[model samples]
Target chain A: MSRALLRSVLELRPAVPRPIASPRILPATQIRALQTQTPRQFNPTAQFVDPQPRPSQLPEQSTSSLSSSSQREPPKQKPNPPRVRLPTTPPEITPQKLDPSVKSLLPLLAAQPAHYITIHIHGRPYLVTEGDAVRLPFLMPDVQPGDVLRLNRASTLGSRDFTLKGSPWVDERLFECRAVVTGTEQEPVRVMIKKKRRCRRKKHVFSQHRYTTLTISEVKVVTEVPEDA
Target chain B: MTIRGLPQISTGRNGVGAFILQCKRLDFHYCDWAGSSRGMNGFIKSLLPKFAAAHPQIEITVSPRPRKHPVVVGHYVNGKTKSIEVKNMEPMQVLQKVKLLRDASGEKDKRTTKPVTSINESVRGIWSPYHGNGMRV
Candidate 1:
């Protein structure tokens, strides 16, 4: 019964009153001032206020004194020392011409199907072919993954039919040999036990070392000579 | 002591391990009736056989080009050709020119100002303004 009475009361209530229209006329300047003042009241902190004192705020006499002092002082001159130029690396010595016999036989050797090369890196010899994975004795410094290193020094470049041997080191411009740095690999931990002869003192030392891994990406006898070649 | 082995592959440099001659073919063009062909005919008859025997890698062809000056055209592996006129020249002079062509790398002759030409990075890195202390006045 009370719910029915509440519903009937709510239905009997009059609709909300619309805003009443005031016929008061304000001047254009007054309306503009009101519009401008509304935003300032809405956000009081919106305008930026610089913390430092502006030049305009200084007294004219002080400003003139400051300007006069600045004019009186000579400009600071920086003495540029002459740049020290370092000597660049010397150019590679041009190689001697090929022997007549070797020149005649080169094409026959190049016509072979497959070839292998013995390359030297840091005075270590590595007999490798294309797509071979090589593990160097020591970690290669200053090299990152995906870095391509050109193997310039080779002792022998040969195939089943022919072999081209170099005296001590081969010329670097003969072949196109590339190695891609794969990543660094870590070895298993090695533990060494140390003990004193007289005393019962014992110590265990554990060690693990990392090595850079590389893959022989390409090894091709450059048949076509490039512009610089 | 931990034993670690780094993986590395051999890099091949052309002319380092072995040099492939750039001049693949030499074409000798001579005129039969022209007086300029006199020395060229002598070179073809006397010196060409020895030259061909010395450089088996290079293919040699002799063709008669009527009314034209005798020219030795060197076909390079880089798809460029260098032609030298051997008109009225001695056989030895023609051989010298042939050697020059044989040794040529097939690129246009360029004046290289720098002494060293390399693909490798500079040993001393570039100077940067952001690094090192600034000079005070």
Candidate 2:
């Protein structure tokens, strides 16, 4: 069948090169290149690096001392942008010194089975527990589905017996809260009618908005306090 | 004799364990002899192949609907279908619409006032004046 033949042809074709890291961290020019270059779209700047390096490339570069040598140095290795990986260990932040009363009552707060946190994103507070769904008002850019976001800014963390209220914002080191980016949701299209008193023409304007959806995956309150704190 | 109900503890939440795209399939319909399907035909010839290859998870099918405007129908895992009429639009514009359909969650649109919704009971139990120690005002 023609479909099988097409599949075979597709299988024989070379795979597209994937970037070493996320495209978001790239410079503005490179990010623009990535955003503009769709599949099969013609882009003069997009070039593929040779997978294997040639043995004589070094000697060829050194021997060719022509005026335009700098322009034609080598195409084997494109300068890969430096990648930033997620931190493996907890980062050092401003430590909080717990009062004697808070230290004693903290055990009782941690003893309770359930806890809740009011996390803030973009200065908006969301009171959520684990397994809750949150649809942010604005579309979150540079995040894909299933990406886990750490909710560090919080005003309150509470349990059955106790509540820790922050003065504007809480210490990020005290608890861990994470949310997974679910897909996006769109509102129905709004059509507005516009007309002028003298003119008979009527204009209809259409607009639709999208919001990013997220689900709280994990919410854990650290039970033990560090010796220094 | 005493009867008991089934014990169910947990509910399924998407993106909690593993995330699956809501759009399951995309059906593109075009007419061979219609003038309105000019852009749709061009898209089917040049762009759809690349789009289909990029998203192997979504099942794509192109069929002919004679003497009618071109339409793009999206089928979701939630057992809902959304169809958009793409008559007289350019191929790039149609591509944008296709991306819109692919990203949608397939739920009916509603104006949401609250940011968070949770089913879990409140962590702090309701306080009653009579139960706790009496306080002097």
Candidate 3:
């Protein structure tokens, strides 16, 4: 009894959802008996039973009662699952805001002249700045027709004049970023000529890649944050 | 029409002090420039005493600007940096200049001071407008 009590205490907390099932712990016979009785008041203990422990569903009290009640009534051999209140949807939490002092650092870092904005695109940081023409290691997609993105996130903001480096990331909230999207730029066509020594078989492949060009318009450090903001 | 930017003077006494320099920006109708020197003298003489009584600090000095848009200039302290932004100008011009100056000052704060958003709320229009875009006349 002490061991059973210890087990019950250890396994008492119900895990994710299905709360009604956790309360009812009767044998299959008792569960069917409860379901069949039309005039009986709803007692959750008369359903959901298993010899092995299934703590997520039924607590120990009803399981004990199931053994006692089964001797008196010869119940049907069917499992009656406890009532489950199906959740319409799960709860969602909004993103939390960073502390203000931390939030203000990003803009100051960006304001450095000739700043290199190292933006992590697909888990890889690409170092870039205004008027930077670049070729990507891989192609990016789902952009068309004058799509302008302000590449605000940066790991470093620096210039020939000065460089204020961030340990890892600069806060996006601290600065105003504006970048113009110049449509995809491409590498010059490459010609590969292949020749075989004996068979007189030759193969040639040509390839070229295009990359998006961006112009950093202005990175203004904001100090007078909007009051309502 | 009272001009500001009278230099702040150390009272030597600490808490209470008086400003050093005196300047005023006064706007009044200019009927004609063709008037004789004696006629202009009459106009200055007519206007001087009332203005003197109203604003004792200023001794009016007049000259016509090319476009006749009146402006006032003076000096003031900003953040940890000693810099000059147009202290006074046409309302629109002051607003524009203050914006550029605030940007510069914010940059200075980044270099020498704490990262909190520097706010000199006294400078109107130079301040970023709130999201709701509201003000009282």
DockQ computed for model 3 against the true two-chain complex using alpha carbons: 0.01
- Pick out the ten consecutive residues of candidate 1 chain A with the lowest summed lDDT: A15-24
Per-residue lDDT tens digits for candidate 2, residues B82-124, read 8999998766557767867887778888888888888888778
Rate residue B13 of model 3 by lDDT.
Answer: 15
Model 2: per-residue Cα lDDT over A107-126, one tens digit each: 78778889899988767788
lDDT tens digits, residues B77-105, model 3? 22232223322222223322222222221
- Models 1 onward score TM values of 0.37, 0.66, 0.30
Error of 1 at A175 (Å): 1.2
Candidate 2 chain B least-lDDT 10 residues: B90-99
Q: Mark the regions of model 2 whose C-alpha exceeds 4 Å error after superposition.
A: A1-22, A25-107, A191-206, A224-229, B1-9, B32-35, B41-50, B134-137
TM-score (chain B) of candidate 2? 0.86
Model 1 misplaced stretches (Cα beyond 4 Å): A1-91, A224-229, B1-137
Per-model root-mean-square deviation over C-alphas:
40.5, 12.0, 34.6
Q: Give the range where candidate 2 chain A is weakest over 10 consecutive residues by summed lDDT.
A: A25-34
**Ranking of all predicted structures according to TM-score, beginning with the best and ending with the worst:** 2, 1, 3
- Alpha-carbon lDDT, every model: 0.56, 0.68, 0.36
For candidate 3, give the lDDT of residue A202: 82
